[model samples]
Target chain A: MADHLSEPFKKSAMTNEEIMKTQREMRIQFIAFAFMIALTFLAFIAVGAEVAPPGFVISFIIFLAFIQLFLQLYYFMHLKDKDHGWANTFMVSGLVLSIPTIVALILIIGVVKY
Target chain B: MSETVDVSRGLPAHPERATLEGKNKFVGFWVFLSGEVTMFATFFGTYLGLRNGTAGGPEAADLFHMPLVFIMTMILLTSSLTSVIAITAMKKNQFKKMKLWMWITFFLGVAFLGFEIYEFVEYVHYGLGFSTSAFASSFYSLVGLHGAHVVFGLGWVLLLLIRYNRAGITLTNAPKFYMFSLYWHFIDVVWVFIFTVVYLMGIGGG
Candidate 1:
């Protein structure tokens, strides 16, 4: 078993259906990539063109950032697939914790100055 | 365990997690990544809190060049895609294609790092030193942490490529490559927030 791990294989175990599924997955990934790029561009344009007030633009870009984040995490990272329940749990918890951390730091450090 | 993975049938569709060791690594890496999230959150919080504390030094609005940052964002984003492709190739047992895509990802990472270095140097010349102000210190630490990750990731993939130059699609290396892809994507995730919160907000007059 140990020796087999280091040796190379001549072919893949993927059946024809699995191969077709993988190809389909790749196409979906490409579409996700395109959406991410569009989101990025829109964020940049919003800031560049000054299409709205600074407050509105800031919120808009941050919203776009969140959308990009979901796309990357779900599609690119495969967090949307089955068998990712634990991965999803850990990541979502981390994200939940982050919000309070950021809010506290901004309110306490930036505003309160304690 | 022996019956579960029959090597004579060729590489598995999910080679990375076919073995118990590989499965453990997969889960462990995600745990570590969760910790990294909080770690980076602290830095992000610090930067946001102190961004307005320029203290007579160069501010974000003046120091950041939109075009340069936009280019860097594009480079990093594209590299993320390339690594995704590489991992997809890995799962498909296309060893040569996987290596090729990984190499492409490495070069793109190097290009992104180069721009980051150039951006930092330009900022220093513009008088935004590490100790120039609260903003400067926090900004450097946050962005610099991300840059260090890029450098580390580059070294990692390079070593993997060199060590496994001739080792075809083996179960042992599959998990390693897959984990690297995840790390690379996380870096891009961090950069997403960096650009939106730091660069965009900086130039947007917030």
Candidate 2:
């Protein structure tokens, strides 16, 4: 069929477009990588330098870690792209269910001996 | 190949999700990973709960080495980047580049396991053996399971390399490589939490 024959032609024709898209994606990936490294450095400095209050340092690094997790999941894992709705649903639900589980585990399983 | 069976000509843009088979594989792997997330969350919850139940043995502050942990974090984070590069190569259909990046990932994984083993040995030398306390048990369970995952991931990449060295970038092998990269990224994500909650907070005496 003509359609079938043209498929290969179309694929071949998209090389330039594909390369452009790849270049864009590669740029975003490099930016995310740099941000992750900077975040890691900040986390170490927050704890190692001992400049901030202990409570603030703990919360700050945890906050930075959450940002890193989001970048890893969305960018590195490609969860932010189209057609990943089910994957996103599953991950979000897992996080939702985990909150209660974690709360109960920490509170109910009280450190009686401590 | 026959026209009837080969619905798409050449490598599809998203070969890992281009066909019915590939879509099933892509979605199914995500479903499995969701469950895995819950499994690790349970381990993490257990660790947080029992972190202070040291049974009067060495606490986290007494055993953790921040500088060594920071180096390990860097190594693992770089390996994640390398695996991402491999995935990028796959997207571009650059088989040789993908293989090279995957090999780099494998070596980084091996290096991480080596450092982890050395870390465990150091902990034991410092008198924090397996049965020392509740904290010891949970820490090993959580972090040890992660190390086990890294070992499995390394073996997987090695197998993919061996089996597909001559096969090039076929549809059959693309999804396998894609999923392996996903798994490797998941390991790095978990380590991000470990260093944050375990090492940083521990050293901070929180």
Candidate 3:
């Protein structure tokens, strides 16, 4: 009589461990958000003044901006948490295409004139 | 309720319609952003090449105003922060706060644009119109593109507000909201480079 009857399964397969894991992920996300905002603001202020040595200052500010860009994409965009492979692939593609494209253009211009 | 979804269970993977179709839209927006990055890169490279092409005119040192650009930067940067607050409100399922915060961002963006327009007008008045020199052209092209972005960004969110006037936070609008935030960040990134390479370096060097 019982042979054909199937046992009832629980609706939620998520367990205490899984729930804890999700909570941990959420906690980490919040921490990352806070950290990104804090660090970007600090650097924004640090390089916040006018200075000499034009080339050096420009390079440093670019460096800091680049840092903030990375943070924004990683944390707020949540690329780190999800679709890691696809996001990285697209980002790398942009980097590869852009660097050589820019350099080559500059070199061509260099050859053309002063 | 095409505009509604149960994100109460720790947020949906995709919000607007909460279906495969909606998720696709979210993914599509990111791809579009990559293209935007490339477009900006082209402008950046062009500016670099033409920066010194002043053609016997005033130089970057005398051209750039540190104080004006500084205030403009703060306005745009804070606008980005406000946009985050908007999204954070959205995540908490608070649609009114989300809309209010988005409007705050819109106002900040408008203020930033005002300063930029004034800055450009000031530059042109000082014998530095686009036709004055190659330096003028490059400077305008670089910062002008940023100004254009701000204008478009304001219009973008406004359209959303109008279109979704009666709707709450949906999966569709959520990604729309998220994409604007991304755009806001990209705008900031470009500005950071502008401040450093344009104002700081230009003033410090020239």
Candidate 4:
């Protein structure tokens, strides 16, 4: 129903046709990447010690890592809001399924219950 | 993207390149990435288990050399950025610019390979030979495979650069440039994991 209602971009919203990433934008994006990486390293240092449980710290870092990953994908990898449906679907599936399946296996194998 | 002036305008023939060239590369890349995800997933599982194993020998905390890995990571990541710049250059039809960036990218990749070779040499010297234990096997295999990919990617980029040095940015070479950039980025993604799982998480001794 919604599909019928929605216009097929009758004249699909034309893009600015401005070529990708101006020099200024590219420079800024690179700087932002550097900053995010620095923050990730800082996170590395923060969790360097025996702070919380190992898993807790790792999960926290991974949460932060995901943000950086998304930033890179959106800005650098160019999978921004303008992407097609398949890219989004594939990414979402990877994020949703890989975590549970992999983590569950790790838990099962490493628990060491006699 | 072929246009035919065949006065037969009744029904246009849309010859779709199987694998959809661009979409094919995209999907094929994803399929390859699936294998990668599964590969890394297995390593994560083993890493979690053996992380505690430490083989009663040594832990990640003692072994991690952050500076070396940090620089290596920086090189790989920087290559990702430059490759994109190359892609961007291609879109604007700047053949020379694309080649320059790709060449720069190629050199950076070689630098990364040099560092990896050195890192492995150091590991062996430090008595962390791959045959030492399960820990060493997984360690070398996972990280080394990534390094090998980088080496492989470097070769691919070099070949493209040489072959297309003068061809300029035609529609034909556009996809090739685009796919290389994709590969370069994927390698960076995998490195983020190596840094986290093998280096960072591996640090702190499990």
Best by lDDT: 1
Worst 10 residues of 2 chain B by lDDT: B1-10
lDDT of 2 by residue, A1-114 (tens): 223321222232226788798778878988999999999999999999998899999999999999999999999899999899998998878777877876666675545434
Off by over 4 Å in 1: B1-3
Whole-model lDDT values for every prediction: 0.93, 0.83, 0.68, 0.66
Tens digits of lDDT, candidate 2, B1-206:
12233434555566566455667888888887888888888888888888888888889998898889988999999999999999887777677888999999999999999999999999999888888988999889989999999999999999999988866666677788899998999999999999998889989988
List clashing residue pairs in candidate 4. A9-A12, B19-B24
lDDT of 3 by residue, A1-109 (tens): 1221122111223446755755565566567556545644544454455443545655666677677677667755666765455656666576567776666655555
lDDT of 2 at B153: 94
Q: What share of the true interface contacts does each candidate keep?
A: 0.74, 0.42, 0.18, 0.18
Clash pairs, model 3 backbone = B15-B171, B16-B170, B16-B171, B16-B172
Q: What's the residue-level lDDT of A59 in candidate 2?
A: 95
User: Tens-digit lDDT track for model 1 on A5-83?
Assistant: 8888999999999999999999999999999999999999999998699999999999999999899999998999988
Candidate 3 chain A: worst-modelled 10 consecutive residues by lDDT: A1-10
Number of the top-ranking candidate, with TM-score as the measure:
1
lDDT of 1 at B195: 99
DockQ of each: 0.76, 0.40, 0.17, 0.17
The residue-by-residue lDDT of candidate 1 on B1-206, one tens digit each, is: 44368777789999988888988898889888899999999999999998999999988988888999999999999999999999989988899999999999999999999999999999999999999999999999999999999999999999999999999879899999999999999999999999999999999998
Restricting to chain A, the TM-score for each candidate equals 0.95, 0.81, 0.56, 0.62
What CA root-mean-square deviation does each model show from the true structure?
1.2, 3.8, 7.5, 7.9
Model 4 stretches astray by more than 4 angstroms:
A1-17, A20-28, A47-57, A81-83, B1-20
Candidates in order, TM-scores: namely 0.98, 0.92, 0.80, 0.80
